[model samples]
Target: MPRATDAPPTATPADAGPAGGDHLGHGLRTRHLTMMGLGSAIGAGLFLGSGVGIATAGPAVLVSYAIAGVLVVLVMRMLAEMASALPASGSFSVYAERALGRWAGFTLGWVYWFTLIMVLGAEITGVARIVTGWLPGVPQWGVALVVVAVFAAANLAGVRKFGELEFWFALVKVAAIVVFLVLGVLLVLGLLPGTDPVGTTNLLGQGGFAPEGVGGVAAGLLVVVFAFGGIEIVTIAAAEARDPQRAVGRATRTILWRILLFYVGSVAIIVLVLPWDAPVLQEGPFVAVLDVAGLPGAARLMEAVVVIALLSAFNANVYATSRMVYSLAGRGDGPAVLRRVSRRDVPWVAVLVSVAFGVVAVGLNWALPDTLLGILLNAVGAALLVVWVLVAVAQLRLRPRLEAEARARGEELPLRMWGYPWLTWATLAALAGLVVLMLADGTARGQLLATAGLVAVVVGIYGVTALVRRRRAAA
Candidate 1:
């Protein structure tokens, strides 16, 4: 028997919508989604955090990207199926509600919400620190507050404005990477006008590509997965797209592969240009590479680009967190006040709530500056893992039912995962492997444990909520 949370095969409010029958305006188009996805995944992680991985694993970091990239592809394939078919405001959480039940939905929704709200501060903190490089006199907390205010307004104005802003933000990031890739090939081939070919000396010289060995590659894989965090935002934004079904399908299809290109390609270029043992690996890999190339003013240019990228993520997360809160509120899982929308059909209360929570994160960063912030960041790290697990599970449960419906209707699904049950199972196994890797890696162990403890509390809250609902129903 189907649970109440699982809607029938026929399209529900999310799929059969005047923008999912929610108050949000449906102004986003295919272009916005494509660019948004492109931009979201290419932020501070690539610009700054890649250094940590490259320095740790040396040239073997490429292998880490390949490993994590495969998992992201599988997860997105599963996501495209559910999102294209269902198309909800809350996305994975809504899918979970239908496939796994209300408890699952509530759990995923709030967990993700908490993660975004917390990451919001971190993104702002990244922006603050990055900008400080350019203007050393500014206080980090002040910059954080200013950016939070600026992007918060951008989010509240309207979904369309947010989409447009993301489109440009993503375009700048894409252009920068494409230029880097071109210059990279030129350098390798010794075709950069006056420069001699650096060739593959770095790749071979660095202790035969796996200098840190397989164990180092495993550790790097954990960091690489974290880099892939923001790619899922396109699906989350799918509910607001003009053609939710087609928009999500196209975005999902195009976005993930491009991410692999940028990430893998960029990492390849960096390693080729600079040896893994290079001291520059301690900072932004892009900056380190450009500085090695001796391009005039490269350092300042790289710093500016990175600051823009971090702020872009800050804007995207602001939009995502608010929408998630609104989605939950609309479904009666969150406080009713968060469900309130404005004349523009924007969730005003939800935006305020998210920004308010972000303020708390900012304060924590300012106050503790060390211990508590680490715990907060690590807690959010496990969020993407839980989300991907639920997304795959939801698709696995929903697939057979969806196929049966499509056959009855004499039509094919707009998007389908190849190898169905088998592929789905394989993806789950792969995710399990990543989790085990997290357990094995000493550096990642704390994050895994912290995230697990956070999940326990959320699950416990759901248990109590379910018990109360049952008791009230019995009366």
Candidate 2:
């Protein structure tokens, strides 16, 4: 198939204002991109969802996390290479179009947008529940509506304002994780006042590592892999950065080790400090660790942090979904109205349309709290995997052309994926293996099937639309 041409590799400072061409505002600084990468990924998945992985695989959950972390690193490295070379709001979806075809980009973009919309609903619902816990008289749906409204207004303000808001929100999350890691290390070493060395008792003592065996570790992998989902927002956000190449390079390089440290490091600490079978793991592993360390008000502090994490993720997702649809509209794959921008260069129509689901979902949550939300969330469980697989595939297809273009220009690419075809192939293999595992696991099977159905629907729509356009031209 003939490849689509790449987006021009041009960038302007975020302060360039409305003069920065007909595109999303370049309002994100390096700090905003960096912190957004961190904050976006470290959400309820780590604080609340990780315990399920631990319960499934014992201390061997670290292996699951390690595998997933390495995959993310490889995937990000590939994305950094493409994103730096051809920065665009569409990010990997654009790369898919260039490397594969328009159909690939259209499918990936719409599916990802749908995934984020569903996630926005879940995030708002989670945040609302947390707030309702603190203020009992407040209704959950009311809190959800207010939270959605506030974030939507913040996003509509302007890209700079949104970047600044995300920067501060992410800072809170990163600081919380750093503090937790520091305290966890001290507590483990018996350095905390009045604590004995925990040693490796909890890690090896509880059913000897892989108690549930390889099957358990595989189950754990399924649980923790999706935790890495939101980090891809960095690439999407990179298009809005003052210097896309520099910002993407720095963020992708550092995000890997930081996520590994935050995720694998934190998980290692949790298992080392507390037995895998401890009932408290189910409640919240980080909070449980602090409680064990005898930190006063640990539960409340962690609860507040979890709320912050969810809100931060919600804010980032709003930015990501809007940019993606705006990119689609710009390419004539979506409604033309979605391409409208404000004086501040914000895609106002796209922003509102992206968050529209959250508003409707609030009512859905209020009406059918149990069934509808779970089905929506579950349907998108495997969406990130689909996106990652496309990123790897697009990188594989585009790398040679990119390298040749770089040589023709007498310059080197801004970033290159380490090991090229070898590592990229390995990442694809691992992703395929993950799909097999998901298919085999009863709980994950439904999600995988649902996602496949979503992909099919997207492709079908693209096909029908293409046929209609061709017929109209012929007529």
Candidate 3:
């Protein structure tokens, strides 16, 4: 394998922008890569947003998760192909640049960076709200401030330290969900204390399982699509992994099943243990299930879990946000200062900037209590979908070229994306459908606009850079 710096320079684009040719530090391990994947994929959304999906689709929400899960599986396969072929800190953004063109990469990279930063802000805000509930006199902003500082320090320590911290954080959430799943199965079997098996009747009895119909399922897909947003963090983390290609293969192969069990299994338990129409489902579905299961301390337990979820997301998002910025700078996509790495091999400058952005977002939320995090988060959500589409497009263009390269070198390509152009096309159509679905939802529509606006800003910057380069070349 060629060192990034040793790899031959790409044929310059007609308007050749700066090439991201630096070698990323090899600081991450196999374990870190695997756990980062878990940390990124499992978040508060599963614990919280599934409630929204259930409210919209009822029992049919399970189908929604299943459908979305299949789509993510396909996307991961595409991601794995590129990550294995060319492991880079920039992940799919680099693939987009190398495979498609410079502007495509630059746009997706910046868009993803913006999305993660806003998401980090939302995580801080979310954790603060939960913390305030436990400690009333403390202002929510104070808690959010403290949460961001602590996680930022942890991230600045180094990639290995960040991974170890995330491993335990991911472990707790994973264990709790597993316990919930076990208990749910028991309760459904009439084995749990003080409860009769609700039987399978609830699955079909209430609104015939598809009460809201296929459109309900389609609407549910909107929420489910957002749920998979964090999975791509695996690819970003892979660049530093001990053996990136293998780590990606392992994580990509296993992620879908874990998500299905954790999400679909947990939701299934919630529905079986309590009525799908239960009032608590409108608030927090997990709490609703635990309350009915006769847990003596369900609220306390859930509050603790939600706080952990928020903090875990906070830690992972900060790391992800900073790395994206560092990659951008390393690749000449942003300010040069962001490319500096500390003695610990951590990109501290990028880390501080990302944390500062999070702190500012927290302050805005505090000043405008009526305003929701959605305003800041909308562009991010839209950017996530766009990045995935870009990955699909990148693979569609690059895979054949890569295969040809491997054949010429007398090396068989290992681990290809499952289907060729057709499966790739199907995935794109699915993404297109999701974007349309998001547009139909009034709340999500604003996010689409903001995302479009953000992309436009990046494109404008690209145009300016191209013109400047052309003028200098002519001179």
> What is the TM-score of each predicted model, taking all chains together?
0.92, 0.95, 0.93
Residue 142 error for model 3, in Å?
1.6
The alpha-carbon deviation from the true structure for residue 220 of candidate 1, after best TM-score superposition, in angstroms, is 1.7
Better of 1 and 3 by TM-score: 3
Write the number of the candidate with greater TM-score, choosing between 2 and 3.
2
Model 1 bad stretches (over 4 Å): 1-22, 368-375, 408-410
Model 3: colliding residue pairs: none
Per-residue alpha-carbon lDDT of candidate 3 for residues 209-266, written as tens digits (9 for 90 to 100): 8778999998888877778778888888877777776777787777768877788898
| Candidate 2 RMSD computed on C-alpha atoms after optimal superposition onto the true structure | 3.6
Q: Which residue segments of model 2 deviate by more than 4 Å?
A: 1-21, 370-373
Question: Considering TM-score, where higher is better, how would the candidates rank from best to worst?
Answer: 2, 3, 1
Residue 201 lDDT in candidate 3: 79
lDDT of 2: 0.87
**lDDT for residue 331 in candidate 3, whole number 0-100:** 63
Better of 1 and 2 by lDDT: 2
What is the model-wide C-alpha lDDT for candidate 3? 0.78
